[model samples]
Target chain A: MNAPATATAQRKTQAMHKNLQAGICFWSFLMPALAGLVLFMAIPMVWGFLLSLSHAQNTIHPGHFIGARNYTDLLTDPEFLNSLWTILVFTLFIVPATFAFSLWLALAVHSIPKGKAFFRTVFFIPTAVSYAAASLIARMSFFSGTASGFANHLVGLFGMQPVQWIGTASPPWYWLVLVSVRLWLQVGFYMIIFLAALQEIPRSLYEAAALDGATGGWTVLRFITLPQLRNASVSILLLNLIAAFQAFDEFYNILGGSGSSGGNIGLARPPLVYIYNVALSSQDFGRGAAGGFIITALIVLFTLVQGRLLGFGSKEGR
Target chain B: MATPMLTTPVTRRQMLKTFVFAGGALLSGCARSDYIDGKLVLTQWYHQYGEKGTFQAVHRYAREYTRVNPHIIVKVVWIPGDYGTKLATALLTPDGPDVFESTLTQAMVEAGQTAPLNDLFTSQDLADFNPRDIALNSVNGKIYGVKMIDDLGLLYYRKSMLQSAGMQPPATLDELMTLAAKLTTPQRKGLFLGNDGGITAMLNVLPWSAGADFLVNSQIVFNTPRTVLAYQKLQQLNQGGSLLMGAASDWWDPSAFTSGQAAMQWCGMWAYPAIARAVGSDLGAVIWPPLDAQGVPVTFLGGWTAMVNANRPHVEEAKKFLQWQWIQNRAIQTDWCVGYGFHVPPRLSLARTTPKLQQPVPAYAVNMLGKYGKATPPLWNAAMGSDLTNAVTNIVKLGQPAAQQVAAAADMCNRELQRELE
Candidate 1:
């Protein structure tokens, strides 16, 4: 009891020294990234946020402030609400599917004992492809309205009336095509992470458990795989959630085209797409910035929730 | 792969080389005074489809201009298709482009990025450009751009298809619809009326036949009974099931006509080359169907413009480039139009007397452009009657009632009018 206070002080000094070291390291690492973060991310973000409180156009060099008028106007906009609803629906479907599919792929590849390297390579290869390339292929295959697409070809082979994928009242079916492509593009990356975690699991624990009669699939999975993957699962879910929330590039290229060509039906217009339309196309930067910031805030909030749930990176005052 | 873009052996050599080579000649490029005489550095901004050739042309033209006068060194900046974001960045900057072509919207005028070109262009230049193009260049009676290229609504179809159908191009909307129905088959459709909301604004011309403007004299014209009827007529054609709605809607290769899927498409002259590519020498073009009453043939005109950067050190040189490229260099204009397959010409002579614009098939499109072509209306924000006629697409997406969407489109126009006017 006499030494406890002294010990605590000693711990405090050690912690302070370590924290200072960490602080120095963090800044050193961040300095390089700071330029990019400020120029590409921070300035644009703040500028966009400022723009939201204005009456502006595409060529408006300097617009006047109108306060919260843009947000208020967005609140009144039916199309805006509808676009939000569409994005919410897209997220609800896509995020879960991505996790389950990635996990399954990881499990499949991990269980392969002899050719683990080969399977890992095969599985992770697709992660290199961008969403834009995948989307183009998907659009050509399923979303295309004419028989020029693969879905129509398959449907024709089966002797059915050709169903419209992208050009219909229920475009969610076409939305699935986009989501599935996103999953295909992302699963490999998460699978690799899961594989790493799986490899890190103690072999002795499994052997000891097997000897103690904890030999079945569910038992092994619950005691070994799932427990081991807590960190990886959390990391993947948080990273992927951020990705899903900011789903823009795929939606933009698929809908808006490479340059300023033209739009078809715009079947998969996510929130980003709608907001971009508000900002650039319609030249209302204020609403666009507001929408983008709101999306960022939502992503951060969800990441916090994920961190609380999964205990990623930090193991302190939760 | 977290590997370096360069290999290990050559990394040091490459680094030193880049360090030595970079910004050296480029330094010389920027070493000169940013301003020459009273002429300041002026940046001109515009979007181009075929950029590489224009880059070479402008660069050569700049060098020539500098050699002759040595006053301004216009830095010809090429901004690709992502013009909106980049242009926004430039506009937000303190030393952004002084003059650039822009869509005539209140946002542009209010931003102060664009100064009125009404004063820049002389009365003669204005007269030569036409009143409607003048209008598109203006926002609230102030012209901020020199309407670079003029576009107008024109009727383009397969001449072979029209001939086989045993009919001439329809002179009235009703006859046009009849001809469309006659031409449609299971393998192909009568026309491709499914381009997002693009053709939506053309509702002005249709309603104009009934003596209605796109917007009212000062508001959106879609809610007018005539525009509604036009929508209804379009809906009827859709209901007759003449379209394969799910086909890839890439307008660049307009699938309908390219794949033998569409008999006709209503478009501006801009689509001429693309149409020619689609049909492979079977393209036929004509002006928009004339009204039965026949007051005057009308079509919407659009084109790119060159804006001078007032802050550029090479303002005189840049102005010389703009003059040579836009005014004096007919050969450049001809080359640009022909190279990018641009249908409209900056100058009048390029289309008629020039061999380049005298394409055998699209003579009708050229004729329409020359004779009855007009630019987008000056007060087009609240005045023109076009509603981007394809609002049915969004309606189809949300499963909203078609009537609701029709009304919503009208509301969109009215809202834009109110916002811009305010």
Candidate 2:
């Protein structure tokens, strides 16, 4: 009996030693990434929150603490409110348009039996282009208000007047320029995501639908493909929504100009641009930081609402 | 599967130690490279000027400074785009430039970003500089910067276009509007303020031309009826479909006027060289016209000013460099002002003596500046400027009521002024 008890005790010690080794390995692997997150992200976030409450003008360090005043000021200010409205309008336009275009491209690519890789690569090429570079192309080449611009030239061919694509605010033609550039820059990335999800749908599922006399392509697509793509569609929508909220580079490059001569054009200004003008241009860091936090909260609330409406993480969603 | 080779396992402690050692080595290497044996390194920044030889000229100036002071090496940083924003952000950090060129904004002074430079100039030297330029660089009776060059904003019109249309250089707001409308053609618009229309450059011009000031004794004063009327006239001109909108180049480039996209453009005297190169003997300039009989012709004076960074360790050294380069070096100043691009020297003595500025267009610009040039008030901060810009954009582009927009802007400016006071 004493020998058996000693053997059991030795086994327990060995198990304990193995667990200790495992714990060390786990922490050793995670510490670097965790340290980086704490240093770069978590610390800055806490500091930014602190800054949002203070009058931090022309300086990053917090000054006089003025609790929620910055937030309240932004809420009441017409320009800030207008920026919020502009972002909302932008998201409404960009999310649906990008979703549909990407999904269509993915479907078209998936249906192609030959040269599928070539077409995929061709469509994906734009995803590699920077937004600022694309905005320059859009502003200077495609939608320039001059008669020589591609859009103007196209309109001239139809005997239509050359429209001030970026300058005019009445018809808000700047929206067309902003949306087209963003779509061109981002659609390919979302298309690749949809393509992966599309390929993951089992061939047997389509076959089973066809066997049920759903021989029409639309019927098969509606019954099997659409339902199968729900998860991907929701995820893409979420990503697009987030991206739309964070729209800055294109609007800034195209509308804000070099920031040396003219100030912001005061049209099509998203939240980021407004914050940038307030914080950097106007040197009102307190309002800028507060605006940033408010925008973040808005994005979170929007994502939550969208996820709930779409059944994002429920079993049926998959 | 391939055979595994025996290797020593690494522990977290060992990894941390290695990282710390590597980091130390890298830091030491950087420090050794940065520290020249017995030389004092000073960094100076300048915004990228859009001229052919301006880049080389600035570097040449830096080289000349080093020659004058062999032990002190000056590093020239040519900031290309968004210089203001970049400079503002950099000024917050310890590693920012020791000396830089920018407008002396109230925020910069309020934040203690600029050092008082009263000691750099004597009474005679201060008297020699343009009084307006001196006033522009001063805050609460303390000088913070020395003017590098003065850029005069005025109207540049195609002589042939105006002649063919049987129009004279406009002297009043109505005449200018009429000339612009009459000069409009299928290939060209009447005027070009900028690519995004005229609100940016014309913001101050409108108020000044209407016999209004942005601030008077640190109080908001740009919401008068005459200013409202000026804004309305500007809106009408923008909507008249004659102002060139969204050109490939902005008003500053002179390409719009040279390419015949606009018959008249609101631009600065800096573009005189480019304009002469493109359209020799066919370019003419005038001050931006006033609103009515009561108002006066207006020219907005803008320029870069060199200031020493107050937060840096080498503040005294930076001040010494600025004094030597901008205040003491007359030949370098002349070359910088006129050699690359045409700019009126900020010093009255220099402007009077510079032969290049004695020519026809430059002389006229100098005269206009002497007569009608208005320097932006030191109290008019960026926040106030932004409010005014927004007001202009809304009134002109979105068809918002001019009076209402001006009032709103005035209210915002008052708030900003109040904050500054506090």
Error of 1 at A103 (Å): 0.7
Tens digit of lDDT per residue, candidate 2, span A1-318? Answer: 699999999999999977876897798689889988998999988888989999888889986898998898789778888988999998998999999999899999999989999999999999899998998888888988788889999999999888888888778888888898888889999999999999999999887877888987788778889899999999999999999999999988888764622533588778898899889888889889899999999999999999999998899644
> How big is the positional error of residue B383 in model 2, measured in Å on the Cα after superposition?
1.5
Which docking band does candidate 1 fall into? acceptable
Model 2 misplacement above 4 A: A1-28, A260-264, A316-318, B1-34
| Chain B TM-score, structure 2 | 0.94
Report the C-alpha lDDT of model 1 over A145-178, residue by residue, as the tens digit.
Answer: 5655678778778886555565344434656566
Clashing pairs for model 2 are none
Where is the poorest 10-residue window by lDDT in model 1 chain B? B381-390
Candidate 2 residue lDDT tens string, B1-422: 14342344455677689789987997776542323568888889998899999889888988888898888888899998788889999899877899999999888899999999999999989999999889889998999999999988879887888889898899898899899999888777889988767788788887799898888787788889988888888889888998888787777888888888888898889999888889888878888887889999989888889999999888898999999999999998999999988899988999998999888999989988988888767778788888888888888888899999999989988888887788
Write down the DockQ of candidate 2. 0.60
TM-score of each: 0.78, 0.94
